[model samples]
Target: MYFAKRNSEEPEIVIENTVVYACESASCNGWMRKDFASENYVCPMCGSQLIEEVRELPKIQTDFNSFK
Candidate 1:
């Protein structure tokens, strides 16, 4: 049996310790990146409080031009 090789290789994903806001409610799984979080640390999903946390997250490129 022979296997065919792919033409291109997948890009490597970069991960880093990123600060985020997590919901305090046990039933809610709402979270947002620190940089994108609003002044208020309120959970939009369940109206609960959000706490600061550090998580290993993949690096993302932001497009500021897209925002109005």
Candidate 2:
């Protein structure tokens, strides 16, 4: 049996500085993107207060045509 070689190259991931709201509670691991967050900065998981911070995250690709 012969095997064929496949492309081993992996796609490059783009990283960007994104603003987010993170939970202040030490035990809670909750966060949300600033763009999608509401006026209330309360953590939905633990009901703790949220604080603004910047983090390096992978770039998200959005297709506007999908909304229609």
Candidate 3:
């Protein structure tokens, strides 16, 4: 007897691996990580400015049992 073929899952893609940082005006007190897909990010409180800090984050490789 013949068996049907099984499809395999696609590999995961690591898009952004850096931590984003932003700071708004002292009075505004509004800052957060901007979405990568977004065009412009502005502070909601004071509308000062939104800055992004991109840095290489460490990657850890382990066995499957690591999740346990």
Candidate 4:
């Protein structure tokens, strides 16, 4: 099997750290943090809860034809 190039440029990959925080209020909405190490970070408004940090997956873009 062989693969074909969809675009002249290769796909870009980026990794980032994020945090998932559950809303303290009844709302299910949550928040994220790019860097957990950062000492500064608070919900946009009150009533929101801070949960735990999580790893964010990098966004990948590719042509469907490549799989064929």
Candidate 5:
């Protein structure tokens, strides 16, 4: 009997020691890695200013230095 390939059940991956920035506007859901965020800390999608925040999100690997 031939068996078809089955999807592997893997747990979600988590990242550590990350800094992020989130929109300060009350009606926005914008957020990004501080290092990769806009130069002015503005939310590109909502045009709102950003603030430093701690969050758990999918890790994004980038070569750009986030520090100013």
Candidate 6:
């Protein structure tokens, strides 16, 4: 896991958190980080349509420790 570092020495600054597309279907628990989402998004778990969702999550940065 390696996030593109915009600045090597500067701290990560996420002014706005990412918007993920999650399955709105009650039977599914699938979502994709918008950055990695495809053109036509669908639930990875149940193949249902997706909808915009804002989760109370901290900004995620790709790093070796995160993969671990």
The number of the candidate with the highest TM-score is: 1
- Ranking of all predicted structures according to lDDT, beginning with the best and ending with the worst: 1, 2, 6, 5, 3, 4
> What is the descending TM-score order?
1, 2, 5, 6, 4, 3
Candidate 5 residue 46 Cα shift, in angstroms, is: 2.4
The TM-score between candidate 6 and the true structure equals 0.58
Query: Hey, what RMSD does candidate 6 come out at?
Result: 10.8
Which segments of candidate 1 are over 4 A away from where they belong? Answer: 1-7, 64-68
Query: Per-residue lDDT for 32-64 in model 1, tens only?
Result: 998899999899999999999999999887885
- Best of the candidates, lDDT: 1
Which ten contiguous residues of candidate 3 have the minimum total lDDT?
Answer: 29-38
Misplaced by over 4 Å in model 3 are: 1-18, 54-68
Per-candidate clashes come to 0, 0, 0, 1, 1, 0
lDDT of each: 0.92, 0.90, 0.55, 0.53, 0.77, 0.78
Which residue segments of model 4 deviate by more than 4 Å?
1-7, 15-28, 34-42, 59-68
Clash pairs, model 4 backbone:
24-49
Deviating ranges (above 4 Å) for candidate 2? 1-9, 63-68
lDDT of 1 at 8: 97
Q: Candidate 6 overall Cα lDDT vs. reference?
A: 0.78
Provide C-alpha RMSD values for all models, in order: 4.3, 3.5, 12.2, 11.9, 4.2, 10.8
Per-residue alpha-carbon lDDT of model 2 for 17-49, expressed as tens digits?
999999999999999988778899899999999
For model 5, what is the C-alpha lDDT against the true structure?
0.77
- Whichever of 4 and 5 has more lDDT, that candidate is 5
> Model 5, 1-68: lDDT tens per residue?
99998879886776666778888999988888767665887788888888997876666655564433
CA error at residue 3 for candidate 1, angstroms: 18
* Candidate 3 residue lDDT tens string, 1-68: 99988768766755557555454566664545433324566765666676776655544345742664
